[model samples]
Every structure is written in structure tokens, then in C-alpha cells.
Target: MLTAKEIDEQLSILQETGRKISECFSSFGSRMDFKPSPEKWSARQVLHHLTDSEIVLAYRLRTLLSENQPKLKAFNQNNWSATLAPEQEELPLMKSCFEANRNLTIRLLKKIPASLWEKKGVHEEAGEMRTYDLVVRNTSHCLRHLEQLQKLTEASQAVKL
Candidate 1:
């Protein structure tokens, strides 16, 4: 169980995610498609993953709040990236989708009662988790990929092409 203060901090981080992503990608300029290697994802692909993750996490959060110990499904992100062809996705549209969904989720989080944050759910792979756990996990996931995007931008700059 997280303290109220801790939960507030986590929510703040979640709210800033889309803005931070835009800031990080601003440095990438024309290198959104630049991958470190053929096997790895590009900045664009990471954006797609983050957007997709926000949508999935929102659904999980809603389920946890509305149901009693609902079983949450796990998604294969790598497979989504490969099959979705994020490299071919339009940057503006992807960003809009991410920001819009994130905004709606934030609004929902803010309006929910504090006790609802403790609502529990069972994830297929992660086992039992509280709604607050999803909040923390999702925020950390966003920050990790934000750092990845920053590193990708640096690597892209280093490459002549």
C-alpha cells in the first residue's frame, strides 16, 4: 500500500509522460526511424509501444476498479511492434493517440476515490496487483522508455546517416 503522498507523486509522473516524450523526440528530429540495430526498435517503435501500453494499462486499471479480482491479460509487446509496423506509423497521429488516451486516463485517476486505488487484480504473468501497483508500474515503464528514447536520439545523432 502506497502512502497518499507517494500515490500523488506517481500520478504526477504519469501526467507528464506525454510531454516528456515529445521533448525527448524533439531531439531526434529526422531520426525517429533510426534504430540502433536491425533487431532493435526505433524511436518511432518505442512511441508506438508506449501508446499501446497506456491503452492496455488504462483498461486494466478500469477493470481492477470495476471488478473483484479480475484476471488481466498480458500483451506481447515485441510481437505488437513487429506486427503493427510502428516504423511505418505516422508520428503525429501516434502522438495524438497517446496524449489523448493518457489525458483521459489521468482524468479518471484523479476523480476516483482513494480506496479504489487498492482494488486488486490478477495479471496472467504478474500475479496479484493493486490499482496503485499499476499506477507505479506504468509510470516506471514510461520513464524507462523515455530514457530509451533519449539514448536513441543520442545514438542517432552519432550516426552520420
Candidate 2:
């Protein structure tokens, strides 16, 4: 179980990471396409995926905090990624969506009672996870994808010179 302060700290880190992502994308001229070696998600695709996830997780957090619901529906991330087209290099839109969703999620987290942190949700593949765990996991997920984006950007830059 995580305290509210800890959750806020995690949210802050996520927001800072989002800012960094926005800065990095601003420096790019051409839109990157999803590559097979990188597991088929381009820089933009990854951002889109993150945006979709943030939306879902934000909803789940709201439900957990407000509805007293014990189990929320599971999501198929891979399927979702496959379904979303990668044409949009709209980094600004992606950043805005991420920021909005994250701010809402943080606000919801702050309002959630500490006693309800242990509420459980059964994911289809991942099995049962606590609401607090879900929030922490989402933060870590964003960090992992951000690192992937950084690595991809570095690799692309190296190829240019």
C-alpha cells in the first residue's frame, strides 16, 4: 500500500518525464515510423499508446475512488496498440492529452481515501492487483516507455552522422 504523498511524488515524476518527452519531440523534423526491431512502435505510436493507457488507467482510478467497485475491466495493450494508426506525429496533441489525463489522475489519487488503497482489481492476464499497485505500475510503465523513446532517438541520431 502506498501513501497519498508517495503517489503524488510518482505523479510528479511522470509529469516531469512528459515535459522531457515533449522537448525531445520538438527537436525532431520527420515523423518516425514504427520499426520491427523496436517491436513495431514508432516514437509517435509509443506516445499514442501511452495516451490511450493513461486514459484507461485514469478511468479505473476514478472508479476505484468513487464507485466502491472491486473489479474493473482489463485492457489489452498490445491489441490497442495494433488498432491505433501511427500517422499522427502530433506530439503537441499527445503531450496535451498526457498532461490532462495525468493531472486528472493525480487529482483523483489525492481525493481517494487512504483506507481504499488496498481495493483489488482482477486483470485478465496479470491477475489481481491493488488500486495503489495499479497507480504505481502505471507510473513505472511511463518511465519504461520514455526510456525506450530515448534509446530510439539516440539510435536514430547515431545513424544520421
Candidate 3:
């Protein structure tokens, strides 16, 4: 069982992720579409991936909250990036979706009783996961991508300078 302080800290990081992503996007300027190589994902793709991931997270949480031992689905993000995320590059809209969904998820999480935090879901690929596990997993996932965006931003900036 995670301590309340630990849970709060994770939530705080998750909340900050959207703001950090927005800042990174703002800083990207001309580098918004940059990719380090042919195989690498550009910032726009990452943005879309994050947005899609958040949408999935919301659904997963709802399933966990309402169902007993729900079977969770896993997606191949690389495939989604190639097929779905590239259709549009509307940064503002994507940003809004990401932030709004994240906020909604956070609000929903706050209302969940501590007893329910351990609600279990069996992911197709990841096996068993608790509601709290999703929270921690997503916090780390977002932070990793935020760092990736920052580095991509710097790389893109350097090339243009």
C-alpha cells in the first residue's frame, strides 16, 4: 500500500505534466515537427500519443472503478502514431484534449476511496495492475515523454541556431 504522501506526490507530478508539455510546445517554435532521425517520432507525434494515451487511461480507470477484474487492452503506440496521430497536427486542440482528459482523470481519482485504489485490472500485456498502479505508471510515462520533448526541443533549436 502506498502512503498518502506518496500518492499525492505522484498525482502532483501527473498534474504538472500537461503544463510542462504545453511549455515545451511553446518553446518548440519552428522545431515543432523535428525528428532526430527517420525512425524517431517528432514532437507532434508525441503530443498525439500522449493525448491518445490519456484517453485510454480515462477509460481504463472507469473500467477499473466499475468492473471486477476487468480485462485491460494494450495498444501499440508506434502503430497508432503511424496510422492515427499523423492525420492532424492541431497543437492547440491536442493540447486542450490532453489537459482536459488528464484533469478529469485526476478529479475522478481524488474521489475514489483509498480502499478502491487497489482495484485490480488484468492488462493483456502487462498482466495485473491496480488503480493506483495506473496512476504511478502514467506519471512516470508522462515525465519520460516530457523529458524527450525537452531534449527534442533542444536538438531542434541547436540545428536552427
Say which candidate scores most in lDDT. Answer: 1
- Model 2 worst lDDT run, 10 consecutive residues: 27-36
The Cα local distance difference test for each model comes to: 0.85, 0.72, 0.84
Writing each residue's lDDT as its tens digit, candidate 3 over 26-81 gives 67766778888889888888888988999999999999889999999999999889
lDDT of 1 by residue, 1-161 (tens): 65789778877898787689756545566887898999878888888899899889879988889999899999999999889888778788877888888888888988988888888999998889988888888888999998888788789889999
Q: Put down candidate 2 lDDT per residue, 1-161, tens digits, no spaces.
A: 66668766776876787666666555555636635365666777777788888888888876766665457777777887777664544677877887788777767766767776777766656677777778778878878988888877876676653
Candidate 2: RMSD over Cα atoms?
2.7
- State TM-scores per candidate: 0.94, 0.80, 0.94
TM-score winner, 1 or 3: 1
Q: RMSD for each model, in Å, please? A: 1.3, 2.7, 1.4
